[model samples]
Target: MALTETPLLFEFEVVSSEDLTFIPMCVRFNLDRFGLRISLAQWQLLPYEDRRLLARFPVDDDTEIEPNFDHALFEMLRTHANVEPEWFAPEEAPAWRNVSAVPGGVANQAGLADLRTPDIEDWAQLAPFQRYVLAKLARKPEANHDFVPAMREFGLAVPRNAAR
Candidate 1:
Protein backbone atom coordinates (compact mmCIF):
# COMPACT_ATOMS: atom_id res chain seq x y z
CA MET A 1 0.00 0.00 0.00
CA ALA A 2 1.27 3.36 -0.96
CA LEU A 3 1.53 6.02 1.73
CA THR A 4 -0.53 9.02 0.72
CA GLU A 5 -2.59 11.44 2.70
CA THR A 6 -6.23 10.41 3.27
CA PRO A 7 -9.07 11.74 5.36
CA LEU A 8 -10.48 9.59 8.16
CA LEU A 9 -13.92 10.18 6.73
CA PHE A 10 -15.08 11.61 3.46
CA GLU A 11 -17.84 14.23 3.40
CA PHE A 12 -19.94 11.84 1.35
CA GLU A 13 -19.70 9.26 4.11
CA VAL A 14 -20.79 11.50 6.99
CA VAL A 15 -24.29 10.04 7.10
CA SER A 16 -25.71 8.99 10.47
CA SER A 17 -25.06 5.29 9.93
CA GLU A 18 -21.40 5.77 9.10
CA ASP A 19 -20.29 7.37 12.38
CA LEU A 20 -20.58 4.22 14.47
CA THR A 21 -22.77 1.63 12.77
CA PHE A 22 -20.76 1.42 9.56
CA ILE A 23 -17.00 0.96 9.33
CA PRO A 24 -15.54 4.08 7.84
CA MET A 25 -13.65 3.68 4.58
CA CYS A 26 -10.36 5.00 5.99
CA VAL A 27 -10.24 2.26 8.62
CA ARG A 28 -11.12 -0.31 5.97
CA PHE A 29 -8.37 1.07 3.72
CA ASN A 30 -5.78 0.76 6.48
CA LEU A 31 -7.01 -2.72 7.31
CA ASP A 32 -6.65 -3.65 3.65
CA ARG A 33 -3.12 -2.27 3.61
CA PHE A 34 -2.29 -4.27 6.74
CA GLY A 35 -3.80 -7.43 5.22
CA LEU A 36 -6.33 -7.64 8.04
CA ARG A 37 -10.01 -8.49 7.68
CA ILE A 38 -12.32 -7.28 10.43
CA SER A 39 -15.94 -8.32 10.36
CA LEU A 40 -18.73 -5.94 11.29
CA ALA A 41 -19.57 -8.19 14.22
CA GLN A 42 -16.06 -7.80 15.59
CA TRP A 43 -16.28 -4.07 15.00
CA GLN A 44 -19.48 -3.83 16.98
CA LEU A 45 -17.79 -5.72 19.80
CA LEU A 46 -15.06 -3.13 20.13
CA PRO A 47 -15.77 -0.19 22.41
CA TYR A 48 -16.09 3.24 20.90
CA GLU A 49 -12.70 4.33 22.23
CA ASP A 50 -10.98 1.38 20.56
CA ARG A 51 -12.75 2.22 17.36
CA ARG A 52 -11.59 5.82 17.67
CA LEU A 53 -8.01 4.68 18.23
CA LEU A 54 -8.16 2.52 15.13
CA ALA A 55 -9.47 5.45 13.18
CA ARG A 56 -6.63 7.74 14.33
CA PHE A 57 -3.72 5.31 13.90
CA PRO A 58 -1.11 6.25 11.35
CA VAL A 59 -0.18 4.06 8.38
CA ASP A 60 1.41 6.70 6.21
CA ASP A 61 4.70 5.62 4.58
CA ASP A 62 6.80 8.28 6.26
CA THR A 63 6.16 7.25 9.84
CA GLU A 64 9.38 6.46 11.66
CA ILE A 65 8.03 3.75 13.91
CA GLU A 66 8.42 0.09 13.07
CA PRO A 67 5.39 -2.25 12.98
CA ASN A 68 3.19 0.64 13.98
CA PHE A 69 -0.56 0.58 13.42
CA ASP A 70 -1.32 -3.01 12.52
CA HIS A 71 0.23 -4.66 15.56
CA ALA A 72 -1.49 -2.28 17.94
CA LEU A 73 -4.80 -2.73 16.14
CA PHE A 74 -4.55 -6.52 16.33
CA GLU A 75 -3.83 -6.39 20.03
CA MET A 76 -6.72 -4.01 20.57
CA LEU A 77 -9.09 -6.30 18.73
CA ARG A 78 -7.99 -9.27 20.77
CA THR A 79 -8.16 -7.41 24.08
CA HIS A 80 -11.41 -5.59 23.54
CA ALA A 81 -13.43 -7.83 21.32
CA ASN A 82 -11.91 -11.23 22.11
CA VAL A 83 -11.67 -11.74 18.38
CA GLU A 84 -8.83 -13.16 16.33
CA PRO A 85 -7.61 -11.16 13.43
CA GLU A 86 -7.98 -12.57 9.94
CA TRP A 87 -5.57 -11.77 7.15
CA PHE A 88 -5.79 -11.70 3.40
CA ALA A 89 -2.56 -10.41 1.92
CA PRO A 90 -3.54 -7.64 -0.41
CA GLU A 91 -1.90 -7.30 -3.80
CA GLU A 92 1.27 -5.24 -3.66
CA ALA A 93 -0.66 -2.62 -5.55
CA PRO A 94 -4.41 -2.96 -5.35
CA ALA A 95 -6.72 -1.65 -8.08
CA TRP A 96 -7.08 1.76 -6.44
CA ARG A 97 -3.33 2.31 -6.36
CA ASN A 98 -3.05 1.73 -10.09
CA VAL A 99 -3.09 5.09 -11.79
CA SER A 100 -2.46 3.74 -15.27
CA ALA A 101 -6.16 3.34 -15.96
CA VAL A 102 -9.44 3.37 -14.11
CA PRO A 103 -10.62 -0.14 -13.32
CA GLY A 104 -13.13 -1.33 -15.95
CA GLY A 105 -15.73 -2.06 -13.32
CA VAL A 106 -15.54 1.49 -11.99
CA ALA A 107 -15.82 2.89 -15.50
CA ASN A 108 -18.81 0.67 -16.19
CA GLN A 109 -20.50 1.81 -13.02
CA ALA A 110 -19.87 5.43 -13.91
CA GLY A 111 -21.43 4.89 -17.32
CA LEU A 112 -24.41 3.20 -15.75
CA ALA A 113 -24.87 6.21 -13.49
CA ASP A 114 -24.60 8.65 -16.40
CA LEU A 115 -21.45 10.17 -14.94
CA ARG A 116 -18.06 10.80 -16.46
CA THR A 117 -15.37 8.23 -15.83
CA PRO A 118 -12.39 9.84 -14.18
CA ASP A 119 -9.46 9.90 -16.59
CA ILE A 120 -5.98 8.61 -15.82
CA GLU A 121 -4.86 12.08 -14.80
CA ASP A 122 -7.77 12.41 -12.42
CA TRP A 123 -7.18 8.97 -10.92
CA ALA A 124 -3.47 9.65 -10.59
CA GLN A 125 -4.12 12.82 -8.67
CA LEU A 126 -6.62 11.48 -6.14
CA ALA A 127 -5.62 10.78 -2.54
CA PRO A 128 -5.39 7.05 -1.89
CA PHE A 129 -8.56 6.94 0.22
CA GLN A 130 -10.62 8.64 -2.47
CA ARG A 131 -9.60 5.98 -4.96
CA TYR A 132 -10.29 3.29 -2.39
CA VAL A 133 -13.78 4.68 -1.76
CA LEU A 134 -14.52 4.72 -5.49
CA ALA A 135 -13.36 1.13 -5.93
CA LYS A 136 -15.41 0.02 -2.92
CA LEU A 137 -18.51 1.86 -4.11
CA ALA A 138 -18.28 0.29 -7.57
CA ARG A 139 -18.31 -3.28 -6.29
CA LYS A 140 -22.09 -3.50 -5.66
CA PRO A 141 -24.62 -1.50 -7.62
CA GLU A 142 -27.20 -1.84 -4.85
CA ALA A 143 -24.99 0.11 -2.42
CA ASN A 144 -23.71 2.53 -5.04
CA HIS A 145 -26.05 5.47 -4.74
CA ASP A 146 -23.09 7.31 -3.25
CA PHE A 147 -20.99 6.84 -6.38
CA VAL A 148 -22.08 10.04 -8.10
CA PRO A 149 -21.94 12.08 -4.89
CA ALA A 150 -18.51 10.72 -4.07
CA MET A 151 -17.28 11.49 -7.58
CA ARG A 152 -18.57 15.00 -7.23
CA GLU A 153 -16.88 15.36 -3.85
CA PHE A 154 -13.62 14.19 -5.42
CA GLY A 155 -14.09 16.75 -8.20
CA LEU A 156 -14.22 14.01 -10.82
CA ALA A 157 -17.84 14.72 -11.75
CA VAL A 158 -20.24 17.63 -11.85
CA PRO A 159 -23.98 17.74 -11.21
CA ARG A 160 -26.06 17.67 -14.41
CA ASN A 161 -27.52 21.09 -13.78
CA ALA A 162 -24.10 22.53 -13.11
CA ALA A 163 -22.78 20.96 -16.31
CA ARG A 164 -25.34 22.69 -18.47
Candidate 2:
Protein backbone atom coordinates (compact mmCIF):
# COMPACT_ATOMS: atom_id res chain seq x y z
CA MET A 1 0.00 0.00 0.00
CA ALA A 2 1.03 3.66 -0.50
CA LEU A 3 2.30 5.89 2.31
CA THR A 4 -0.12 8.89 2.30
CA GLU A 5 -2.74 6.14 2.37
CA THR A 6 -2.03 5.54 6.06
CA PRO A 7 -3.98 7.12 9.00
CA LEU A 8 -1.84 8.69 11.75
CA LEU A 9 -0.81 12.01 10.21
CA PHE A 10 -1.56 15.73 10.33
CA GLU A 11 -0.14 19.08 9.18
CA PHE A 12 0.51 22.71 10.13
CA GLU A 13 2.42 25.70 8.81
CA VAL A 14 5.93 26.10 10.25
CA VAL A 15 7.55 29.50 10.30
CA SER A 16 11.34 29.65 10.43
CA SER A 17 14.43 31.72 9.83
CA GLU A 18 17.84 30.36 8.95
CA ASP A 19 18.39 33.88 10.38
CA LEU A 20 20.99 34.49 7.69
CA THR A 21 19.82 37.70 6.04
CA PHE A 22 16.42 38.15 7.75
CA ILE A 23 14.09 37.47 4.85
CA PRO A 24 11.13 35.96 6.76
CA MET A 25 9.75 32.72 5.33
CA CYS A 26 7.54 29.70 6.06
CA VAL A 27 7.49 26.00 5.27
CA ARG A 28 4.70 23.44 4.95
CA PHE A 29 4.63 20.16 6.82
CA ASN A 30 2.89 16.79 6.71
CA LEU A 31 3.61 15.55 10.23
CA ASP A 32 3.72 12.25 12.10
CA ARG A 33 4.64 11.28 15.70
CA PHE A 34 8.04 9.95 14.57
CA GLY A 35 10.58 12.78 14.66
CA LEU A 36 13.37 13.92 12.40
CA ARG A 37 16.44 15.79 13.56
CA ILE A 38 18.43 17.79 11.02
CA SER A 39 21.63 19.63 11.89
CA LEU A 40 23.18 22.89 10.72
CA ALA A 41 26.16 20.86 9.50
CA GLN A 42 23.77 18.65 7.53
CA TRP A 43 22.19 21.80 6.09
CA GLN A 44 25.63 23.32 5.49
CA LEU A 45 26.71 20.19 3.56
CA LEU A 46 24.68 21.42 0.61
CA PRO A 47 26.64 23.46 -1.90
CA TYR A 48 26.59 27.10 -0.73
CA GLU A 49 24.30 28.00 -3.64
CA ASP A 50 22.03 25.03 -2.96
CA ARG A 51 21.84 25.95 0.70
CA ARG A 52 20.67 29.48 -0.10
CA LEU A 53 18.22 28.22 -2.70
CA LEU A 54 16.71 25.65 -0.33
CA ALA A 55 16.13 28.32 2.33
CA ARG A 56 13.57 29.83 -0.02
CA PHE A 57 10.02 28.51 -0.49
CA PRO A 58 9.09 27.36 -3.96
CA VAL A 59 7.10 30.14 -5.65
CA ASP A 60 5.07 28.00 -8.01
CA ASP A 61 3.60 25.92 -5.18
CA ASP A 62 3.80 28.59 -2.53
CA THR A 63 0.87 27.22 -0.49
CA GLU A 64 1.18 23.47 -0.82
CA ILE A 65 -0.99 21.04 1.15
CA GLU A 66 1.71 18.52 2.03
CA PRO A 67 0.62 14.96 2.55
CA ASN A 68 0.88 13.51 6.06
CA PHE A 69 4.33 11.97 6.44
CA ASP A 70 3.27 8.35 6.32
CA HIS A 71 4.74 6.12 9.04
CA ALA A 72 5.26 3.19 6.75
CA LEU A 73 7.27 5.44 4.45
CA PHE A 74 8.99 6.85 7.51
CA GLU A 75 9.89 3.34 8.62
CA MET A 76 11.05 2.51 5.12
CA LEU A 77 12.88 5.82 4.71
CA ARG A 78 14.00 6.59 8.28
CA THR A 79 17.68 6.12 7.45
CA HIS A 80 17.48 8.51 4.52
CA ALA A 81 15.06 11.01 6.09
CA ASN A 82 16.68 11.98 9.37
CA VAL A 83 14.12 14.74 9.79
CA GLU A 84 14.97 17.50 12.25
CA PRO A 85 12.57 19.34 14.55
CA GLU A 86 14.62 22.54 14.27
CA TRP A 87 12.51 24.18 11.56
CA PHE A 88 9.53 24.89 13.85
CA ALA A 89 9.27 28.40 15.29
CA PRO A 90 9.20 28.84 19.06
CA GLU A 91 5.60 30.10 18.79
CA GLU A 92 4.61 26.72 17.36
CA ALA A 93 6.55 24.95 20.04
CA PRO A 94 5.03 24.50 23.51
CA ALA A 95 4.24 27.98 24.81
CA TRP A 96 7.11 28.98 27.07
CA ARG A 97 6.88 32.52 28.46
CA ASN A 98 10.17 34.43 28.49
CA VAL A 99 10.44 35.32 32.16
CA SER A 100 13.12 37.96 31.54
CA ALA A 101 10.90 39.97 29.19
CA VAL A 102 8.40 40.94 31.91
CA PRO A 103 5.45 41.53 29.61
CA GLY A 104 2.52 42.66 31.73
CA GLY A 105 2.29 45.34 34.43
CA VAL A 106 0.20 42.95 36.52
CA ALA A 107 0.09 39.17 36.80
CA ASN A 108 -3.08 38.90 34.74
CA GLN A 109 -2.14 40.50 31.46
CA ALA A 110 -5.31 39.40 29.69
CA GLY A 111 -7.43 41.04 32.36
CA LEU A 112 -6.24 44.48 31.30
CA ALA A 113 -8.63 47.44 31.44
CA ASP A 114 -9.76 47.19 27.83
CA LEU A 115 -9.44 43.43 27.41
CA ARG A 116 -11.35 42.17 30.43
CA THR A 117 -15.08 41.82 30.94
CA PRO A 118 -17.56 40.25 33.37
CA ASP A 119 -18.29 37.62 30.70
CA ILE A 120 -14.71 36.37 30.75
CA GLU A 121 -13.52 33.58 33.02
CA ASP A 122 -10.08 32.82 34.42
CA TRP A 123 -7.19 34.70 32.75
CA ALA A 124 -4.77 31.95 33.69
CA GLN A 125 -6.58 29.56 31.38
CA LEU A 126 -5.02 31.31 28.37
CA ALA A 127 -1.96 29.80 26.69
CA PRO A 128 1.36 31.17 27.92
CA PHE A 129 2.22 32.79 24.58
CA GLN A 130 -1.25 34.36 24.43
CA ARG A 131 -0.70 35.76 27.90
CA TYR A 132 2.75 36.94 26.88
CA VAL A 133 1.52 38.99 23.90
CA LEU A 134 -1.30 40.51 25.92
CA ALA A 135 1.06 41.08 28.83
CA LYS A 136 3.54 42.91 26.62
CA LEU A 137 0.75 45.00 25.17
CA ALA A 138 -0.46 45.78 28.65
CA ARG A 139 3.01 46.97 29.76
CA LYS A 140 3.62 49.33 26.88
CA PRO A 141 0.12 50.67 26.35
CA GLU A 142 1.68 52.70 23.54
CA ALA A 143 2.40 49.44 21.72
CA ASN A 144 -1.27 48.57 21.69
CA HIS A 145 -1.41 48.56 17.93
CA ASP A 146 -2.50 44.95 17.92
CA PHE A 147 -4.07 44.96 21.36
CA VAL A 148 -7.71 44.84 20.26
CA PRO A 149 -6.80 42.93 17.11
CA ALA A 150 -4.91 40.31 19.03
CA MET A 151 -7.66 39.94 21.57
CA ARG A 152 -10.42 39.64 18.98
CA GLU A 153 -8.26 37.51 16.71
CA PHE A 154 -7.66 35.05 19.51
CA GLY A 155 -11.36 35.22 20.54
CA LEU A 156 -10.29 36.19 24.04
CA ALA A 157 -11.27 39.86 24.16
CA VAL A 158 -14.74 41.22 23.63
CA PRO A 159 -14.63 44.73 22.27
CA ARG A 160 -15.58 47.47 24.70
CA ASN A 161 -17.44 49.18 21.85
CA ALA A 162 -19.54 46.13 21.08
CA ALA A 163 -23.02 45.75 22.59
CA ARG A 164 -23.36 42.78 24.91
Which stretches in model 1 have alpha-carbon errors above 4 Å?
1-7, 16-18, 59-66, 141-143, 159-164
Which residue runs does candidate 2 get wrong by more than 4 Å? Answer: 1-120, 161-164
lDDT of 1 by residue, 7-119 (tens): 36667877933456677776776777777888898888887766766666554523244346677777888898777779887767668878888987778778877777787
Q: What TM-scores do the predictions have? A: 0.81, 0.30
| CA RMSD, predictions in order | 3.9, 12.1
User: Best candidate per lDDT, number?
Assistant: 1
Tens-digit lDDT string for candidate 2 (1-164): 12222221111111223432222111122221122334545444434433333334221211133233333233423344454343333234212244333233432444444555423233455555455445544565353444555566557565446676
Report the CA-based lDDT of candidate 1 relative to the real structure.
0.73
Q: Which prediction has the highest TM-score against the true structure?
A: 1
Q: Give model 1 RMSD, 1 decimal.
A: 3.9
Error of 2 at 112 (Å): 9.0
Candidate 2: pairs in clash: 36-83, 36-84, 37-83, 37-84, 38-84
| Number of clashes recorded per candidate | 0, 5
